[model samples]
Target: VAVFTDVDCAYCRVLASHLGGYLADGIALQFIASPLSSRGTPTYMAAENVWCAVHPHKAFIKAYSGGVPAPAPRPCAVIVAHDSQVAHAMGLPGTPGLIGPHGAVLGGYLSPRDLLARLRMDAATEPSP
Candidate 1:
């Protein structure tokens, strides 16, 4: 699953809290920054900070644990900004936008079990090739 998330989004935090459940259900998550804050704001910077860390995956996990790294390199801001831009371009209404493996829009912030069920249902409904 690819999730468009924000550092300051409570829903994103809830989704992060369910990381174990997602992984246990064989859902490999890809986090994409989609900050609700404008560029240069602390919240947006927080997303950039995660990208700046030597281990961004670890930093991203820590960020959802109520913390973010120090201010990021100016360069990293571009990547984070691009992530938000891409999410916006995709027309996602808000953070924690959930996209299923086969491009299904899984709505937002669903529990792992529910998400898997949705995925399975979608797969079942698809016409056989």
Candidate 2:
């Protein structure tokens, strides 16, 4: 799944806690920062810091796990901005927008089981390449 996420969304933190559930279901997550969703939130800076961390993936885990990411190695405004633009172009409503394998965008929080079920259904209906 490609998730459009805000680095510090409370609901996103809840979802992050279920990472094991997602892994058990054979789902891998690709997190795309949506700092543009930072209207009333404070995660925009966190998003930049995460993206610029030496080990960005680990930084994501830390951020979503309710821990602060390490300081960025370099300036990261551009990449973070680009990610937000891509999310906006994809029509993501807000943080935690999940894009299934077949390009279906599901919004908000879903348990791993629910996510797997939806993915399975979508896959079943999609034509094989």
lDDT winner among the candidates? 1
| Candidate 1 local lDDT, residue 25 | 98
User: Stretches of candidate 2 above 4 Å error?
Assistant: 37-42
Residue ranges of candidate 1 with Cα displaced over 4 Å: none
The digit string of per-residue lDDT tens for model 2 on 35-112 reads 654533457778888888889989988888788887788887788888888888888877788888778887778899
- What TM-score against the true fold does each predicted structure earn? 0.92, 0.89
Task: Report how far residue 66 has shifted in candidate 2, in Å.
Answer: 2.0
Model 1: weakest 10-residue lDDT segment is: 67-76
Angstrom error at residue 76, model 2: 2.0
